[model samples]
Target: MRAAERELMARLPEGALMQRAAAGLAAACAELMGRVYGRRVVLLVGSGDNGGDALYAGARLARRGAGVTAVLLSPERTHPGGLAALRRAGGRALATRQKEDAAAVERAIRSADLVVDGIVGIGGKGGLRPDAAPLAELAEASRAAVVAVDLPSGVEADTGEVRGAAIRADLTVTFGTHKPGLLIDPAREYAGSVRLVDIGLSLPDEAEAEALQHADVAALLPVPGAESDKYRRGVVGIAAGSSRYPGAAVLAVAGALRGGAGAVRYVGPAGDAVIARFPETLVSDQGPKRAGRVQAWVVGPGAGDDAQSVAEVLAQDVPVLVDADGLRLADRDLVRARKAPTLMTPHAGEAAALLGVSRGSVEAARLHSVRELAERYGATVLLKGSTTLVASPGGGPVRVNATGTSWLATAGSGDVLSGLAGSLLAAGLSALDAGSVAAYLHGLAGRFAADGAPMGAHDVSESIRSAWRDVMS
Candidate 1:
């Protein structure tokens, strides 16, 4: 972003970039307000260009007959040109150093219809400063709508880590291109909705992270040809469930049947339950070695103390997907030694276990945690949560699944995802493609099954075909 800004600045006159940003911001704020005239707008000014953008935008609002007040956090370090422009346009400025000024700032926040948060930019780290923390709290408690310039204050732009108090904007108007923090959460939760304003800066085709849309997922889904049969399409092996939890085996097989794979092979102690629920399953209790030929293997869903099966599947040359108990039972050396692709699907808790960190640590810094897990495991890792992320060991762009609802937190959801992803792998997609596409379909299916109501894991599994058809349509 810095490089793109520098290149654009070199070709244009001084202050041109800031002017463009302020104009876009002012327009967005106007649209939000419905009518800017006679509305109360408060600008939270900082010490950098972010403050400059807010002040200039405040000037635009003031010119349109709106009451504008600039609360400068750093009086001596505020933008000179921006402050001059705001003053010229009849916008009032107040400093937070004195108790009286602080009280006035609070009063302004309480009565304002709109508050523009420009206290910190993408470059600012840690959290809101002690002087500015109270203002952030005030804005949050206010009934007024908060609009963030560039990004919300105190968010780590690259990592999306909010270590302390951060502004929760109702809307964030970003400049140039989208930052990684805006797409990934914990910071994404703070940025309510994002609007990107183009500033004519050229960027690279490949980014550090990317979110897949409907068109992208449609192109990656596997479709069978006229001459294709069950073997040609792909057969996926499932080694899940135990006597204690036979339902896991049934759910895994259910998901694999709906996936692109032509056939599903189930090998576990729950063969009777698997055949009863999914009569089409090729059942065998002799284990994965004699479960018939399969293009890929999915291991460890509900296999209580089933480390032997996980090890057996890892020995195979075909692509392997490890999930649930498999994530816990599989050996680190065995996973890293795989010649073919290995995909590990883990929630925050499982990822923390693998990384030897707390679940809170992994949840706080999801981007860092996922990437580190991929690099450490030497395989493709799919870290599932509010925003499911797929990362490969090659250090390319991580794929983020934007679809899904809070209802997906139900039981056996991860099993369905493992079967779907393993089936995709057997169908000739790469580890990255399989993990990302499965996550997309699973999330979409979860949304369809729930539809604002509660749904079981089997409901999500049954909705896969509908999700696939929706994508294909």
Candidate 2:
């Protein structure tokens, strides 16, 4: 998989790398243009290699008979060779030095058939500098296809977190491998579609990658044999909801029902509430030990802050998903001692609590936080939020779920997700697969249920079968 460290190589001569990048970038631009002979192209050039890449690509476009123009934001520090090449290929190179110049450049952007953004790259610290900011804004307002070289300017390369403003690109021609920022959120929102360009960099070992495609997810989904019965599929015991918040228990059970588990054995205080909502669920109030054998457990969705219930769930040897209230009550070692796998699904607030930090810290550096949780707990961690991420103890690619909507912030949504994931584990998927696949489907279901309108937690749970249909179909 591709990453930031692999993309930022200093071993080779800077000029050689730029040339290779420019070649791939030009090819991508050509593919976008289809017929470059008469197209008008604008190159937004800055002061670094990103700017150089745009200039070089512009030169190639101009050589192929396209009308190319390079707007220099920083004339004094522009790439000399790149500027020379564009000029030699009959492309107009101009420098802007005024506030109104941004608008004028925007007009030029509007007139262009395509725009190449080389304003910033991995090294940029803040949002767009004064001049480049307006230019990027204007490009956003324009109709031309915007292709970012390396990554969208102002986006973090190592993490998908966006600190300040950033340009939204239609396509990003990245080098070597993928950057973590390209796969994560906020930054991922600005990156429309990512295309990898091989520069022959020997990358180091990666800790994680991103979401599994359809075929990959299909491979990971549990499939029952003809001889299989509900018992063979494994049972999931749930400790969720209460009299005051019985809806949480019902929704959690709603999620677990479709989780492919043979049966759901609910062992919480609200057994009557669970039976009332989901009569199919096997309900018990006699604690986990008497709830019959289960392959996995789901704890903490509305389980209240009662330390007793959290302690009972953690005491089980089955694979456990510690979420919501359980994240607060359960000791980390109890989870560590589990013989079966452990999965932790914590939204920003819960994750912050687990790490003893502010919620803002977890949001700002989600990639780091997820990895840290997995490493610290020795369990798979699914950090839920804008860009839900799944991190594993044994490093692979961190899967980033892209299908969630703001509407999913509705109450009880997480309870449904936790139960769904718990069921996947009971069905025999690894903790990572169970959690990631559940996140993916849950997000899709949330979107399907909402359909741009508001929805309740029950709506989301009911839509799971539809989302399942989407995957199965």
Candidate 3:
């Protein structure tokens, strides 16, 4: 953003970019408040461009007859021009660093109709400083609607890690482009609904991360042609389930049936169970290699200690998806040696086991953990969580899945995801695309199945067609 800002600023007039941003911010604030006039607005100003954005925006609100107050964290270092504009527009300013101004600061924030968090910008790292941490708490406790400038204060812009105190905003008005922190969670949870204010900054085609929207997913979804047959469409092989966990095989096949794959071939001890649940699935008592001609293989949902099965599936030349028990049993050396694309899906616990780190660490730093896992495994990784992330082994832009709901956290959910993703792999999408697209569809299915309530893994699988149709429409 700094580079793009520098490039744009060199061509445009001084302060024009800030003005463009402030105008949009003020407009959004006005819309949120419904009426700007007589509304009390508080700006948590710091010593940076973010503070400048809030101050300038506050000036706009003050001009429209709203009561605007600036609580400057660094009064001496505040943006001079912005302060002057606010003061000129009949807005009041209070310095929080002063011992005597604490009461006034608290009172103003508590009574305000809106609180604009400009205490820190995207450049600010770690967390809020001692002087400003209290403001974040106050904003949280207040009845006012909180809006963050660019992003919530103290979030890591490059990664979504929130080390310490960060403001929880009802809205975040960002300029130029959406920061990576704004999309990934922990920080995404801080930044509520985001409103991007374009300042005409020409950014590069490549980005650190990307999110696939409805149109993007729709474009990638496979549609059958008139001449296309079942074999041509693609067949996915499932090497999962054991004597004790036959439901895993059943659920995996359930997801695969709705996952755009023409045929699903099952090879496991749970053949009768799978056949009972899904008769269309070609059942095989033998191993993966003998499971007929499969375009791709899904291994390790409930193969419980079946190292041979996992190894056999990994040896296949076709694309392979490793999940659940497979993630643990599959050899890293064998996975790295495979010529075909390998996609590994692991939750925080599974991922931690692979990286030899605490699950908490993986959950906290999802972006880093996913990337590191992909690099270490020499394969594509889908880190499943509240925010599912797909990282490619080659390292380009990691895809973040935004369609997730909390209700999706249920038993056998990963098994369903494994089948769905493997089906996509068979349909000829790249490992990265298949993982990301499956996550997107799965999340949407979870939302539809749950629909504000709890749902089983089977319910999620049943709703995949609904999600597919919704995305296509």
Candidate 4:
């Protein structure tokens, strides 16, 4: 973002960039207000460019007959140009450093219709300083709608980590492009709804993180040609489930059926149960070696203590997806030794166990955890939770998925996801594409199945076709 801003600033006038940002910010504020006139807007001004943005934006609102007040945290260090502009445009400034101004500042914020959080910019890190923390709390507690400039104050611009107090904005109006923090959590949870205001900065093609849209997923989905047969389309083999947990294999097969694979072959103790549920499956009691030719294999859904099955599947030349019990039972060395693509799906708890860290630590630093695991295991890692992330072994743009709902936190959901991802892998998608695409579809399916209510793993699997259609349409 800095590079892009710098490049655009060099060709423009000294204050041109700030003016453009202020114009957009003011417009968004006005739209949010519905009627700008007679509205009370309070700006939490600091001694930085972010404060300058709020000051200039406040000046615009003042010109439109709205009552604007700038509460300056650093009285002497406030932006001279912005302060002068606000004062000239009929907006008032209150220096909060003085004890007498504290009551006035509180009153202004509490009674205001809108609060603009410009306390800290993207450059500012490690959360809000002690002096600025109170204002954030007040803004959050107030009934006024809050808007953040560039990003919510106190969030790590690149990493999405919030060490301490951070402003939870109702809307975040960012210039140039979307920052990594806005797309990821725990920072994402703070940035309610994001509005991208293009400042026309020429940015590189590469990005730190990426969120795939419908078009991207649609383009990646496999479609059969006129001459394509069931065998030519690709077959996905399932080595999951035992007598104790037959539903795991059933759910896995259910997900695989809708993953664009031509056929599904099952090899486990739950063959009878799998056949009973999904009669289309090619059931075999013989292990993965003799399970017949397959483009990909999905292992470890409910196979308890079945380390040998995990090993046998890993030894195969085909692409493999490991989930549930397979993640724990699969040998790390054997996974690293695989010549074909390997995809490991794990929730926070599974990830923590593998990384030897607390679940809270993994949840807090999801982006870092997923990348570390991918590099360590020499495979693509899909870290699933509120925001599912897919990272490659060599490192590139990590894919972030947020299409799911809280209802997706049900039993056997991971098994379905594993099967779907493996099927995508069998259908000729790379491990990276397979995992990310599967997550996207799975999340969308979850939303459809849930539909503002409770749902089961089977409901999500059944809704996959609807999700695929929605994406394709």
Once fitted onto the true fold, the runs of candidate 4 whose alpha carbons sit more than 4 angstroms away are none
Name model 1 segments beyond 4 Å from true: none
Residues 1-473 of candidate 1 have per-residue lDDT tens digits of 88888898999999999999999999999999999999999999999889999999999999999999999999899999999999999999999997788788899999999999999988989989998888889999999999999889989898888999999999999998888888788998898889999978899797988888889999999999999999999999999999999999888888889889999999999999999888899998888888889999999999999888999999999999999999999999989999999999999999999999999999999999999999988999999998898999969999888688899999999999999998999899999999999999999999999999999999999999999999999
Checking candidate 3 for backbone clashes, the offending pairs are none
Worst 10 residues of 2 by lDDT: 1-10
What would the per-residue lDDT of candidate 4 be over residues 1-473, giving only the tens digit for each residue? 77888898999999999989999999999999999999999999988888999999999999999999999999898988999999999999998888989999999999999999998988878899999999999999899999999899998878888888999999999988888889888888888889988877899999989999999999999999999988888999999999899999999999999999999999999999999989999999999989999999999999998998899999999899999999999889999999999999999999999999999999888889999999999999999998899999998999998888889999999899999999999999999999999999999999999999999999999999999999999
Model 3, position 234: C-alpha lDDT score: 96
lDDT at 424 for candidate 4? 97
Task: Give the Å error, residue 327, model 1.
Answer: 1.0
Write the residue-wise lDDT of candidate 3 on 392-437 in tens digits: 9879999999898999999999899999999988888999999999
Candidate 1 achieves a global lDDT of 0.93
User: Candidate 1: TM-score?
Assistant: 0.97
Whole-model lDDT, candidate 4? 0.94
Residue 73 of candidate 3: its Cα lDDT? 92
lDDT for 383 in candidate 3 is 95
lDDT (Cα atoms) of all candidates against the true structure: 0.93, 0.86, 0.94, 0.94
User: Once model 1 is optimally superposed onto the true structure by TM-score, how far is the C-alpha of residue 206 displaced, in angstroms?
Assistant: 3.6
